[model samples]
Target chain A: MDVRSQVSMVFHLDKCIGCHTCSIACKNIWTDRKGAEYMWWNNVETKPGTGYPTKWEDQNIYQGGWERNGDSVSLKGAGKLRGLKNIFHNPYMPVLDDYYEPWTYKYQDLFTAPEGNDQPTARPVSLVTGETMDVKAGPNWDDDLGGSPDYARQDVNMQKLTPAEQEVMFQLERMTLHYLPRICNHCLNPACVASCPSGALYKRGEDGVVLINQERCRAWRMCVTACPYKKSYYNWHTGKSEKCVLCYPRLESGQAPACFHSCVGRIRYLGVMLYDADKIEAVASVPEDQIVQAQMDIYLDPFDPKVIEEAKKNGIADSTIEAAQKSPVYKFVKLWKLALPLHPEFRTLPNLFYVPALLPSVGTVNNGIYNSNTNGLWGGIDTTRLPMKYLASLFSAGNTETVAEVLKRLMTVRWHRRNVTVGDVDEKTVNAALEDTKMDTATADAIFRLTTLATFDERFVIPPAHREESIEMLENTGDVKGNTGFGFKERPARGL
Target chain B: MFNATLNQFLFVIFPYAALAVFLVGSIYRYKNKGFSVSSISSQFLEGRKLFWGSQPFHWGLLILFFGHLIAFLFPRAVLAWNGEPVRLLILEIASFGFGLSAFIGLGLLILRRVTTPRITVVTSKMDVVVFLILLTQIVSGLCVAYFNRWGSSWFAAFLTPYLRSIFVFDPDITAISGVNSWWLKIHVVSAFSIIAIIPFTRFMHFLVYPVDYLWRSYQQVIWNWDRRTIRNSTKHSEGEKSTNN
Candidate 1:
């Protein structure tokens, strides 16, 4: 019986207000130690600019994960599969400085009196060793698009094209621009786990949560370099590497991860997933564009009796099966098919899905404001009208249509104050608000079916009294109707 | 009378004492630990790159020390082998070059320990002190080399005979003549201080070597008694369950 429990997450980008509540929550919970001052386990970054810790996505500088090889996939620069047989080492990984140099301001620098001054000035100083320099870069530098305009503008070289070419470039730049909030993807094929020389890192079989055993960590730091997301951090003082654990303690108590729970936008959803263990590699290796759809196809249908039978045979608990049957991710990702995987090109088969974001029209800015009818709130500075180059700098590939589509979807997912008196607006009202003010009935039905059925299916069933009694009796007796624990009664022992 | 007193103490007493302590102490420490021909063959065959580098550096430095001891112990014999001027020139050159090589090798070894992350993490505080002391020894040795160049024959005639006389347990009252040069005094004081510090510092590595060298070759053993106990308990429980059934 191979009862492998899988876990997954979805982040509705539209719900994210970019307030960095999640980042702050994660910092206060985990990274607020002496050596961990610079780590932000959860960070929000604006698109178009090189992210915090600078140029993280540029794999050329910090090689990580695997690259495509024709129709197959192989670890980056590792020549062939046969050559990889004896080689147990993984080379690509982040260094200590790949995150940021941890720094703190000295309070003495603020209170100390200047040589000639009558009173002390309240200026901040580096708290770490009292060295004073303007420390700017750290995690989450892109929060709230602080440096958006620079990323929005197109290059002059792009403008030198003919009218048609310029028009295409403009669209390309505008299309490419969108905000990307990132966190540990908790990849299905986690390179960090595979690369650890000591086997100190493991993905839990119960919930598929990855963890590092600090006791076993010899500080080789291979996990730091293997992670493409550059999420792992090295503690210089402790001489060990640390990373996100996905708040397992909280999850066990039926609460969301700290970052997810504290998210200002209420964009995160936690759920169980059931997948055929055999199909994981096959689905993950599919080409990038088809990956999201391929992953959805691999999900076992909850309604199938065969699946339930097989699951029971495999020793899967009823509660886990119930959770998978009702998972919101299974709905949005597999049923309604509205969500997309972040950076499918990474090839780690990331579980976090995003409902794409859509931006309002360029000319519709009312004093640089855009109103979201779904949330009944105003967003600052409609940058949709910005030039293509500027947009290109924010979003990779300079694809405006994809950016707009993603933003629109994201806006729908944003947390709006639930309307209590409105008599429970049907899926039509929600889909109408989401689908550009003119909702199609079929789309609304699909959304409604997913929202309600997915929720209903996820609720775990409390075992009936009779069933519990029977199970407990069987367990105590070590026999159920003539069946022994191992499915056979002990043979008559040979004469001692 | 000054020359007679100087020759008695410097040539006879101090040389023998320094020689006895350095040689007998090192040899006794090495042999008492059961290090012998068998151990030497094992270590020589199994030593790593760091081991090779450290071994040669210590051996070369020790040989250089003996060269100094011989000049002080038997000034007349040394002068007979080569003229006094020629012997003085060779001693000065050899000591300078030996000190330089030791200093460079120590620097490379220290840097290797520091810059290699894994190695740096394992380094102890005592290791740092030992490196600093060796550095001081090299710098002070260079000072003595410089002072010898001004008048090698004159310096050797005064210093060597006086040092050899120290072996006779006679106080060299006149060896201090013209030794007022602060640089030369500093060199002498620092050399004696370094010798005193060697046993206490990571320079203790020299005392422990060859024997300590074998410890690295042996595989580390870790016992898990707790897990074994748990397995035994589980087996006991399983046996009881079978008996009940």
Candidate 2:
């Protein structure tokens, strides 16, 4: 067992309110520069609508991740020979138009232009060309109107549902939307790393942060093609690929990432997860249906004495182990089994997990009585506003049972709490709800507390990064003492 | 020097001068700006034309290069290989096929540069000049090959001796003058001029070939050229992983 600690994250989709505060926060901190204005490192995508970079999940067009051959898998778009052949021009790469023609208003014109008879307006100009242009599109053009046919009709997930079901989803009253704030998965099996011909992209051994070394990037642009999430962006100015660093500088200092800190709903959870490194390939190579179980099996329990001993032997700090034990991500993902990795079928074995949102309103209160007139306090998963098949495709590789199980556990918690707070839910129905979900009172109560009322510390159990030793090993510590800066001193430029 | 004829300058002075500049300039470039050595490609700007232009051009050029190399280095072997009349016919036909492709590809590329607005905007004067020079060289070489059929069989007897004489510092201008073909002279001089101009242009990228890329692992971490520091940190990271297990 080659035990290694990966700094994993879990976003509880239930609590997400679809505010793009996280997106703005991350953009302001990381991507508000030349060639990067269009990149939103943390964009909150409204599900049922085609996302930023428009229909990124349609791997048929983008060819982003691994595709199953007979027994093994290869990158859908690239291999060694194919990569070299297409190095001159990537056939599958998305251009600026695919994301959006990022624009800024000609504010100078507003200030400097001579006053006219009509209201003088600052016309939108393309950031790339600095030319006055019609405002065509944006990063989140289909923001709140996820159910509208103009945007949601193109959603890749809609293909999984039957025609009738799809038609039902578009119904005015039945139309429901949920936020899916995306960042780089920082996958254990990163196709971007494998696709990079220059080998500029690598997952750091210490923290599992995938970074593109700007100095070494040859601008092959394969990373942009290989990232299934489309998180990697090509900086035309720098002639290099850039991606989300997961705010590693803040992570090392025991602070939440900018997006996480600024999140209005506090949906993001950060923590350490100890997994057996030896199993990564085997787990990732399995059939799509078995991928979730395989991923779960890879993550060794923090409380396991054998795993704990091996972790210490592998040079993991004691504090990090303690933090792993306290990680809400670990509880949500491995223990409570509430969260699932997005598109596990993509087979990247993504590090970021999502607790599938229970979007269907359980019941309405009529005359001060909570009326869930079903078999018990919780209604059937099939009747939820967000269809079971949709969540299943997103989270469980079309395993409706898995999505149902998580939703049942969540519903049990809700019903359990409702019984306590309000007398409308009878004692028998409450017990039945718990029994039907097969969840104990203690687990349900814990889930309720963590989901609803978790403090910042409880939500993000940051492990001590201990980056000094790594840096000291790489350079003369005494010689480096005077300098205090992040990343390369020189700005990366084209042609080298 | 003003009194020197064009042939006198092209044959003797130009060869020596070009060779000297080529060697010195290549060395200077390798030392001062080693990292900037890359074939900066505008393939991303207008790729469809490049697909047609670049593929045939690269293939024809590569095959021609090896053909020239083998013929030059092992003239006796080439003579023996061409003893069979049928083999000579095959060799002549293949050379014509490759040379035609090269000609066509080069013509299309030049046309593309002028027509494609995106590529034209990035095209420097040096790039245009180099393109025209290559076109002239190919045309001259093709004209000689077409006019003097079975020249490859006889080239060993004439040009090889002259080239060998030059390599030995013997300066056999008379032996090259023995061929007395203006087209051949134009081809050789233009080819030499291309060599001289290579270091100053984007052709420097061809020097740092990506041969190592074929067999390497996907993930690579560059350590800013400090081997010892990288090794130590790698060991430390391994230790971190090992103890954590």
lDDT by residue (A68-181, candidate 1, tens digit) is 677656555222231122122233334334455456545575556567646555444443334455655556554544554443222222332356644533453234334556
Tens digits of lDDT, candidate 2, A1-496: 8777788999988889988899899989999997688889899888888998999998998899887777667888876887877775678888777888788998787788787887678899877666688987898889887336778888899889999989888877567889899999988888898888766688776678888866456667787888889999887545567899999888878899999999889888989899998887778788878889889989989999999988877667788889989998899998999999999988888999999887865445589986655563446565787788888989999888888888888888888898888867778877887898788899988998898889999989998765665464344454433455434444344564
Task: List DockQ for all candidates.
Answer: 0.02, 0.23
Q: What is the TM-score of chain B alone in each candidate?
A: 0.56, 0.85
Native contacts matched by each model: 0.00, 0.13
Off by over 4 Å in 1: A1-3, A70-72, A77-97, A108-119, A122-130, A148-179, A364-496, B1-245
